[model samples]
Target: MGYLICILLYIAGIIIYGIVMGKKKVKTSDDFVVAGRQLPFMILIGTLLASWCGGGGITGSASVVYLYGPVVGTLHFAGAPIGMLLLYFISSKVRSSTKITVPEVFAARYGDGASIIAVICIMLAYVGLCATQIKAAGNIISLITGMDANLATVLSAVGILLLTVSGGMISVAYTDAVSALLMVGGFLLAIPLLIGRAGGWSEAMAAIPAERLTGTGGLGVIAILGYMIPTISLLLGDQNMMQRFASAKSAEEAKKSNLGLFAAEITVCVLIILMCTIGIALFPSLDVPSNIIFSLAVNYLPFVLGAIVLVACVAFIVTTADSYLLSAATNVTYDVWGKYLNKNADDKQKIHFMRITILVLTVLAVVLTLFFPTILSLQMTAYTMYGAAITPALLFALFSKKVTKAGGIAGILTGGVVTVVWTMVLNSPYGIASAIVAVPAAVVVILLVSALTGFKGEETYRRLYENSKS
Candidate 1:
């Protein structure tokens, strides 16, 4: 009950902070969406770390490690570090280009058709991304408090919606910095306590299966690749990450922030894997492995420490949910409605639309929880959808000067269609991830179509690349 109360208070406090920010700092859509493109490097680092390593790392990655083993967990997460490194290069180009959303980047290069397709794909991907965070939050709250999962989902959604709609990026980014500190502190504190309770390293190592200790956990090569590709693709094209770059004060700040984010992500990934395996050692007969972290906090640790860790984990869930919700709403407002539906809409009008869109998207995210059994299950699908559909075109157009507009359109269409059909219709034939098929398909289409159609123009590419220089 103390854990529950502490977490509830934290949630209430952040929501109130968000409301205050909305009234004071978010008068214009620019302030609301990107904080007027002036976020400092330290705040960017915190927001990037906080948003990236949330429920996805804590709940989704932990569940994979518990069920599969360290090998799969390592493979699943290896792409994130690689993706962040790649983003280090990609961020400068994005910041220099001054594109607010990924679709805006697409529109600048590939024209309106590319932008429209990107809007559809972004909405599809982000709604699922947001849904996974919402589900993870509900799972943690339910496990700790013994509340009904459905009620927990509703409550979690409401808090996330409030935080996201309250002040857009301004609220989300500042709160995320605090959440990141709490997350790292919570895990650091729990490590010693958990090890003491588990009877030390050697006993803990012997408690789980020997196969789980191996490099592959007895799994095949294709299975590992399936886990890796989606993660890389998701990081490569994540609009939430892209928007953070756009929010940076300068291109150099955006580039430097990735270094900080890379360090934070690696630390969080290693700690989460350690905690999950330890969870298996402590509770070998646990019926549900996905609840490993929360179960340990409630049942294994002392009261004060457990409450702190619990609140931190809940903060992780809340921060991530709100980030994606705000990103997706930004897509509808700036990319979709602002361009096509309301070309002359003022800042206040766009901000109102963004709030309405956020409310609807939150409802959809909650509804999606009923379909997936776990956060990890939906995470892969959502990640693949964005990585496969959007990343190829977005990256190629941003960096490749000779790339034709036709090629961008072809890549988007092929990648999006292939991922949906393979996952939903074919049900992942041969146990290969949709990313294994979709990413290569998108790349192939981009290359072939561009070669056939020839270059569209070099001046736009030249302008973007020239400004991108540090």
Candidate 2:
């Protein structure tokens, strides 16, 4: 009953906040989509941290750390911070652009054809990513409330849709900021308590399999790299990340936010690994590894602390779902419907269309959750699909003057196609991750094709370079 009250109160506060912000701030499409490009440094950093560390980081990473050990799990989770560190160098460039969606950025460089492919690839990946959050949310709720899993999933999807539709980026970003604080504080407080509960750090270490303490955790090097690449690739070109950068008050603020995110992300990553390691010690016989953190919250911690951490986890999942859902909806509203269908959509029309897209996509995500067996599996597949398909081409277009239109199109098509075929058609042949094959394949196609096509002088690259200089 205490857990239920905390969770419900948290949800209600978020919803009410969304409603209040939507009415006051979301007056125009810009306000709805990017918070009118006025996000301060702290909020931007918080949203970036919260959004990225969602179900994938919480439930998914917890599962991995429980199965493997701290060493292997830490390496597996290193991709995001590494990617954020790299992104810091280019975040200024990303923020300087006026585009709202990644597809818009692509369309500027490679034309409408490339944008269309980007839309397809982004939608595929983001919807799957959104589904993972919904699935995680359901799992958390079911574990806490003893509700039916499927019904909980449907309720989770509805809550995310409501929050997203309420104020778009305004509500999402602000809620993300709040969520970030709660998440960090809750986890930080729980760590020492959890460590003490597990009979201190050394005793906890003695409780687990010795092999789990090894560097590889008995998993192959290839598999570890496979797990790492999708996250790095996704972070490098994730539309959600780009949108947060775009939302910053200035290019400098965007760059600074990355630095903050890196620090926070590293802190959270270490905490997750430690907490899950403690979980392994306490619950070695548990059937489902994904439940490690939640189980710890319920069984290990004191009631109030457990409720707080659980609420924080819920906030993470909800914010991530809405952020991705809103980003995917942006692709449809700006790239597809506004660009091709209406071409002259007013602010009201665009916002309306985006809200509708949110509803439609939420339903799609709920259906997608049925296909994947676990949050980690779904998370990797979505990450690989988007990372392989869009990251190489987008990065090349942004950083290289040699990239050609034909090359960009070919790269997007090849990367996306290879990821789909490798994962779905071939069952990830030999259990190798699609990213290992697909990312390199995309990069090669972009270089080889661009070389053949010859430099055509990318106007977008030239423009962005001039902007950076000025």
lDDT of 2 at 219: 95
Q: Which window of ten consecutive residues has the lowest lDDT sum in model 2?
A: 461-470
Worst 10 residues of 1 by lDDT: 461-470
Badly placed stretches (over 4 Å) of model 2 are 463-470
- Residue 424 lDDT (model 2): 93
All candidates: TM-score: 0.97, 0.98
lDDT of 2: 0.91
User: For residues 282-339, what per-residue lDDT tens digits would candidate 1 score against the true structure?
Assistant: 9886776777888998989988888888888889889998988888888889988998
Residue lDDT tens for model 2, 5-41: 8987898899889999999999999999989889988
Model 2 per-residue lDDT at 385: 94
* Candidate lDDT (C-alpha), each: 0.87, 0.91
- Pairing residues by index, what is the TM-score of model 1? 0.97
